[model samples]
Target: MTHRISCELAEAPLAPGEVAIVGAGPGDPGLLTLRALSLLEQADCLVFDRLVSREVLALASPKARRFYVGKASRCHALTQEQTNALLVRLAGEGRRVVRLKGGDPYIFGRGGEEGEVLIAHGIRFRVVPGITSAQGCAAYGGFPLTHRDHAQSVTFVTGHRKGDGELILDWSALAVPHHTAVFYMGLANAGTISRQLQAHGLPASHPVALVERGTTPEQRRVITCLGELVATIAREGLTPPTLIVVGEVVRLADTLAQPAAQVAILAEGEIRDRVGERVAL
Candidate 1:
């Protein structure tokens, strides 16, 4: 029951003074790449985010120094500038530093920005990509991002607005048919997302799926339509780390879903009562 990598294709060890910007894919330790696991095992210092699962962290070197720099809406353990500076200082100290992110570092995880800071300071670093939330959520939620009959293309969007300002995105582009749109950090703006897409020509009854805490044991998949998206979230009490998937492909979940003990699937007109009381929609 021991898994081993062949010596011929063995990963290079993380060197001293080198920063490894690694992705800890979508709350599932099993989804981690061999390179990411190797780097984590070799890392002497780890600066990680909130979404990086505890199970993933437990795989790292027991002696590694851990720093929590998780960011949530309106709350941050450390600012982006401070995190960048911390990486620079850690690398300067000749430590095998790992800047672990929740999903693919480059996709909305701000790995590019952090890399720029590292380069500016003449620090050595390497990026190890992880499976982004969109892919993870789609697969685990029993929906495909693209299908020949449903969707031809997929788009990833950030649902977070800039400090009380409106979400300024190309509505016409997003509301197109035969396309899947996955929004990250968008739980707060569910109403706006529902309205904008509708205004842009997408019907109110367009299929939508909300995957909460995707890829984790507590994962919940809520199946609803664009018009009832806001209400669905409120009724389900879905929280942050949820991914909003809007497209016809979401309807495929009814037939394609794989049963899981921990996953709860709630579809329109048929919702499970998690609490003691049942409230029909």
Candidate 2:
């Protein structure tokens, strides 16, 4: 079967000296959008991060100059200032720079900060939103972020901070019942996150799902509860790129989730169609 990946509605050719800040979606290479795929083919320079999957990076133009500016929890390949400066320098040299980030660039990916810097420097730029981790992770793990029966709203928060600083999240608001709370980059702070939520009045038995390497072949959806979150993570040896989803909706995973291997084999059209319908609500 000829799987024709269409670019019929592609955007205008990427202009020289313009920065295209694109989201790489979650780990699945299949989630790359037509626009994001087009930019990868046209970019003169590709700046990507750690969370971006190798399969997605392989899609970039062979002639494109690749620069890895990935940052781990405590280790940064290039400081934020350095990355911003690099983008400006690349543009000044008349390069069509593609700043690819894992998940949606705007959602906790610091695309906004980068865009502000570009604007300050009077640089032309475009942002192509990708499937945020919360969306991709939840969908791949087979759970809804919001459900009329389970949750009324969803909140996304980061669980760790630079150096020895603690995560300053509004636990009281997060502890509210009938809502979903997702913690990005929360694996390391699982103990604190679980403890804080419980302390803030959420039931100790509150449902929690730790999605590791979400939407990829290595994906592991560890179903547990708030009380055992820290222990579960340690027992499973889960790593970064794990999204922590806490709420009653997690219980639906047993019935809703199709494993990543199963989902990965589906046609692109089928994947998009199914995911689109779920997200529209």
- Winning candidate number (TM-score): 1
Q: Estimate every model's Cα lDDT from 0 to 1.
A: 0.86, 0.85
Q: Candidate 1, TM-score vs. the true structure?
A: 0.91
Cα distance off (Å), candidate 1, residue 15: 0.9
The ten-residue window of minimal lDDT in model 1 covers 267-276
Off by over 4 Å in 2: 1-10, 259-261, 265-281
lDDT tens digits, residue span 37-103, model 2:
8888888999999999998998887899999999997689999999999999999999999999999
Predicted candidate 1 versus true structure: per-residue lDDT over 1-281, tens digit per residue: 53543323355577899999999999867788888887888889999999999988998879999999999888999999999999999999999999999989999999999999999999989999999999988887778999999999999999999788988999899999999999999999999999999999999999999888887766777888999999889988989988999999998886786555223323212333222244322
RMSD for each of the candidates: 4.5, 5.6
On lDDT, the leading prediction is 1
TM-score for each model? 0.91, 0.90
